[model samples]
Target: MIKQKRRYFSFLFVLPLLVVFLLAGCQLQDQFNAAMSRLAATQSVAGPTLEATKAATSEATVIATAAQTATAVANSTLVLWVPPQFDPNGETLTGKLFNQRLQQFEASFPEYTVEVRLKSENGRGGLLDSLSNASLAAPATLPSLVLLQYRDLESASLKGLIVPLDEDTLNVIGQNWLPYAGQLSEIQHNLFGVPFAGDALALVYRPAQTPYPPSTWQELSTQNLPILFPAADPDTLVVINIYQTAGGSLTDENGEPHLDTDPLLKTFSYFSNGAQSGAFPIWDTQLADFSSSWSLYQQQSSGYAIVWASQYLQGQLPGNELTSLPEINGQKITYAQGWLWAIPQGSSQSLEGARHLLDYLSEPEFVDQIDQLAGYLPVYQSGLDAQTNPDLKATLSELMNSAQPLPAGSTINSISPIMESSTLQIIKQQIDYIQAANAAANQFK
Candidate 1:
């Protein structure tokens, strides 16, 4: 009976050892299967991994090295913040094109991957607002790069929300960039943004109704056809155009606004007289925004209107003629604005990687695609010449020559409301041109 008990105890000990051995074997098999699966998937996509094998390495060392390499590649990622207009999940044409470009960018740079976040273009809770919130609340979540309009660069830079581009980076882009594009990116002599897309003001007129298109504001004001323009829009581009055309300076020597000058009075008087003479339709009251003014032009309610190049491109206005704003003192001048690629101050991505991606996107080839798909003009001069569409090419060429980068410190947000109110008062005949211009100018002071 003692010998039987000893055998049974021995059996129990052996049984536990056997169970441990089985469990270990199963774990080894699982790890082996996972490694093999990963290898197979890599080979299928990348075609035979370029991993080098050491002549005298053990199997365990090889596995460890491969695992480390995979982890490293998995961690290389970039996050980009774009407007909702470029959201890949959306059905818009630009969205699809941007997604395709993003895929190509990833394929071209195998070591890095990109994730896109969509943000609203405008509003209290928009891209800029979100950036402000993120900067204050959780800066770690800020994007590696952001696409923003030219007007935002000054405010963003002043607030320390974006980093300035180094001279070397600027040199690389400056080689092929248009003069205005470079100018658009500069803030107090520092480059804080890289121009990607551009828009300029142009005159959109119906050729059937008006055989001759006016070349200057003076001529446009004297025309018999009911001229329409966004005189009341908050952008105040029309006001700027007129003010500049009449030899008015946008700012004084102290960088204060020079709105009450003789040139401004003359420009205002031209518009006020036009309103009283029935040359300009009383559409300012109805046109509180560009879209409303554009709608009026689109519905053929007016013979001519001033519009952005994008609007003209999108409208494909039939039987219409597009020309640079009428020549003032034999000089054609128009305001130009652009969207830029800016790196936020607290981005987690390596500067080298972010710059590489931006340079790739700014290539002439990529800019060409953007111009073709989106209505924005290319930042490169060569891209404009390469356009296949004759009409578009001619119009862009003329505008490009006359295009002036929006003046620094001339943010429309601050100046628009004042200009809009003054212009509206003048149009309503409630205030004389001198009085209105002085009032608008004083607000800036």
Candidate 2:
């Protein structure tokens, strides 16, 4: 009975303690809710510090976005380096076309800017040497875009200085560019450039003097009239014109040098024979010194001359009918040559702006401009179709259809100087050697 009574009292004491604990827990919960409500009210009021923090975060985001946009805009400005072929006069077709179009491009694309700069080394200075120096110091005053010769593509590409353009960019330009331009873009399937300019061998003749250009070497040899080949030292240009007409290949598939010695020898033999026969003219020393290559044909003393198509077209003809050179075995061909525009290998602006420039140059309308100004045949069908002048259009159509591109590789570059030198020398040597051989033959016979 005593134990039961003590147990009951203990239970009563513990129940009071449990109730107190419950009350304390409830009170703590109420205090936490009240504190949360106070915080909500404070946030609703939006104190200056809180508002400032939010505004600062938003402003920072805007600043970050603006910085990113500015960086992109800066990147869109292309730094282009063009070869020094253009004189300051901007008189020639090449100069007029490039400079005028560049101005138009700038005005059209306000979002993009093109900075035309001069290349330290180009043409005469040597492309490979310039490219090497530029690669070592890329992205620092380096050209993001460059206008390079088509012939130098092999060397530049092999050195890892240039990047292959994306297929989209290539298709946009390549599908409609000139045929030779498209050919120059690839070297064993690797693309390196876009066609920008071209000049081909043409026969400028005066119909008033010779009525018709000879169809064979015999006619040229038989005619007593003086004929000029310009650049008395330009034997290589003449030789290549002859060699290509004869379907000669200077390089093989593996990039091996393959000059057909027999063709050169045969060509030299012809020159020797022709000079003795009084078929070759000795009056002119060089092609350009004679008031342009076409000046040879324009000369009243001359009947026909082989010259650059662009120069001839740009020249003022004096009622003289221009036609392709006389045919050999009905082949009826001439030496076709031109240049491509390429970005430097290590150019930083090569990504987007450079691509845009290339595309602009390669577009059909731009190609038409080049054709009209330079007298270069447009490689793209659309450009030719757009031509309005009947005579020019007809001539360009014939040239484009008949033109065959020069072989592109290091072999062409390697042997170009040799061909130039050898041809010039051979022409000079032929005169003396042929006369001596002729005299010696008579004595022996």
Candidate 3:
């Protein structure tokens, strides 16, 4: 019995150790299964995580590249060469309005910027003269665009300083422009510039003195009122006015001067008789430019005066009436000119950007605003239709429709001085009208 008890106690002790070993084995098996499950989950998720990370990195790279490209595009700029007459800092009304329009242009075109350089409109150090110098000195420094007078078109084109506008650009600009507007930019059947403003010769008189505006030269000659015009001015438009009214043309179909014609003779005769008869003011010889004649007229020195439409608009000639030139042979004729926008040769700006700015400037809305603000005749019919003053609109419409462009050619540069000298001689009684006409015409030959 004692031996049996000892064996039983030993067995119990061995049972506890075997139970502990079995528990440890179970724990090890459980740990192994959990580790296997974690490994399997990691393997399944790894491919998708890597792909998602790659997609995020690619998207970020694309976004960064797009931003860089946009920044580059936004940094582009356009440079414009304009006259101080349209100065933004000027005290004139047109100057103030021009600056406003410039601001609007800049705001509307956020992707591009504008830099303006002031240039002289006339004289030895004028815009074209400066451009010619720059072309010779440093062609690369030329402006992308230039504001030019209609008279400058012929010379600028001959010099190859400006580029002809493409057909696509012309088409986009549309065909609603005025007759003279298009004519100003048309050179050798090719379009070169865009017209911005229209100016014409018109008679300005105080309404109180002349309730009846003369429609014919006979009626005007009969009035006995002293007429004021820029007889001594270098611009030939005054001479052309009388010549054209008398059915004379300054240029032949080939753009050559036809100065000694019967029409010119008649025009000179009319002016000489009028001046000698005391119908035309003798003081006009002292008038150097339109401004001087305009000043004299403003002082009520004469009953009638020929002045530019631009001056009439600028002066706002209150209590004054505007009309076309006196009729000859029942036909009225006048000279019209324009300021044009043109791109210089070898512009650094991208064509797209330059075209965008040109398009913006030619918009009818902007043109209308310019008309209202500056008294410049609108280039578009829509602008004309928007005018609040019916009489002014009608007058401008009639003048715009009937007005002819000044003859454009190399000969044009010489035509003015010759005409001026002949007219001055006839008025001064130094030569008879026929002699003056013959002498002037011979110079063109």
User: Candidate 2: lDDT over CA atoms?
Assistant: 0.61
Model 3 misplaced stretches (Cα beyond 4 Å) = 1-75, 89-108, 170-172, 252-255, 442-445
lDDT over C-alpha atoms for residue 353 of model 2: 66
Number of clashing pairs per prediction, in order: 2, 9, 0
Q: Report lDDT per candidate.
A: 0.75, 0.61, 0.76
Model 2 residue 320 CA deviation (Å) reads 3.2
Candidate 2 residue lDDT tens string, 318-420? 6665566555556656555556666665566636667777776666676667666666656667777887878767876666656655555554555556555
lDDT of each residue in 160-183, candidate 1, tens digit only: 999998867643567577777888
- Report how far residue 4 has shifted in candidate 3, in Å: 65
lDDT tens readout by residue for model 3, 80-166: 787776666788877787777778887987778877888889777677887777777877667767888877765787788889899
Name the lDDT value of residue 384 in candidate 1: 83
Model 3 earns a TM-score of 0.79
Cα RMSDs, all models? 12.8, 10.5, 12.4
